[model samples]
Target: MPKRYSPQVRAEAVRLALEHVEAHGSAYAAARAIGPMVGVHYETLWMWTKQALSERAWRAQRGQSGVATPPAG
Candidate 1:
């Protein structure tokens, strides 16, 4: 795997990117706005923001009794 931004820097970049998207309503646009602040390409910034949002959503509903896990095939 390619060495990219530090984890802490990536996380902060993601947070900032999310805020930008939430305010501006577009991930690409947000990435463009945020790319310079952090040393990441717009595509990487967008991917990081998406990954962070997905993780947060997953964590918010983790371990709920009513949620079913699919059986391994």
Candidate 2:
């Protein structure tokens, strides 16, 4: 059975993964390095990191164009 994680835990894992990716320039490497420490599968952590980064990029783009982001569901 898959274990459930709290939102705080998920957010922290994403943050760590993103930091690792920024430092290493590779999501795969970031996941491999941080996943075990955080008790998440590398692939799962990578997906979370990717989604967070993508959302940030979208927000930045909208900000540059002076548009507001729709509230996330």
Candidate 3:
């Protein structure tokens, strides 16, 4: 079975991954670097980051702040 992570953990991982992306190269790299430290799989973290970032961009196009709840999967 897949492991279940809390919303707070998802958010933090997404946040860290984004920061890592800004400082580094790609989201994959961010995930690879941050996942182990946060106890999440790299692929999982990357997906969460991608989703959050896409949502953020979608919200930005409408002039809204990014405060979306990560979707449950």
Candidate 4:
């Protein structure tokens, strides 16, 4: 079975991915840099980053409507 990550570990992976994006400006590069911290594979990090960005965009849209719905899986 694959290992499950704790919330703290997920947060750390996200943080590391963001830092890598800031430094390298590419998801592939960011994934390579951030993958080890939480045992996320590079492909998984890419998917997570894409999901995070989409969620952020959705929240911004909902914020304009004054209704902040949680992200859907």
Candidate 5:
């Protein structure tokens, strides 16, 4: 079976992915470059970053409108 990572590990991976994306200007590129170094698959890291960014966008939108954002899957 594949190893399971803790929430903190996942969060850190997402954070790293985000920083990589910001620096590289592409999530795919960021994942490809940083994933292996971080011990995560590129596609997995991409998905985590995508979800984190979406959640942040949702929260920002809700904050602006004073409404709650729906939870992401």
Candidate 6:
């Protein structure tokens, strides 16, 4: 079976990946660095990072524009 991570773990991983984005030059690179420490695969971490950022942007824009956004999936 695949390993399962809790919501808090996922959120922390995403936050860590974002903090390192500038230093690492991209989400993928940040994930590569943070993944081992957080016990996640680089690719998985990168995807989570991307999703978090996308949702944040979507919400920010929705607040400003007062428009409904479509589901990311």
Q: Find the candidate with the highest lDDT and give its number.
A: 6
Each model's total of backbone clashes: 0, 0, 0, 0, 0, 0
Q: What does the lDDT read for residue 73 in candidate 4?
A: 81
| Candidate 5 residue-wise lDDT, 1-73, digit = tens | 7777788878888888888887888888888888898888888888888888888889999999989968668
Relative to the true structure, candidate 3 reaches a TM of 0.81
- Global lDDT of model 1: 0.77
Tell me how far the alpha carbon of residue 25 in candidate 2 is from the true structure, in angstroms, after superposition: 1.5
Per-residue CA lDDT of model 1 for 9-66, tens digit only, reads 8888888998888777888789888988788888889877777666656655565555
Q: 25, model 4: CA deviation in Å?
A: 1.5
Candidate that beats the other on TM-score, 1 or 6, i.e. the better one = 6
List lDDT for all candidates, in order: 0.77, 0.84, 0.86, 0.79, 0.84, 0.90
Q: Per-prediction TM-score, please? A: 0.70, 0.82, 0.81, 0.69, 0.82, 0.88
For every candidate in turn, the CA RMSD to the true structure comes to: 4.1, 2.7, 4.6, 2.6, 1.7, 1.2
Pairs clashing in candidate 6? Answer: none
Can you write out model 2's per-residue Cα lDDT over 24-65, one digit (the tens) per residue? Answer: 778878988998999998888887777787788888888899
Between candidates 4 and 6, name the one with more favorable lDDT.
6
Worst 10 residues of 1 by lDDT: 64-73
Displacement of the residue 35 alpha carbon in candidate 1, Å: 1.1
The parts of candidate 4 lying over 4 Å away from their true place are 65-73
Instruction: Please tell me which model should have the higher TM-score, number 2 or number 5.
Output: 5
- Residue 65 displacement in candidate 4 (angstroms): 5.3
Task: Residues 1-73, candidate 4: write the lDDT tens digits.
Answer: 9767787877778778977787878877898878976688877787778788778789898979888777778
Error of 2 at 1 (Å): 3.7
Model 5 compared with the native: what TM-score? 0.82
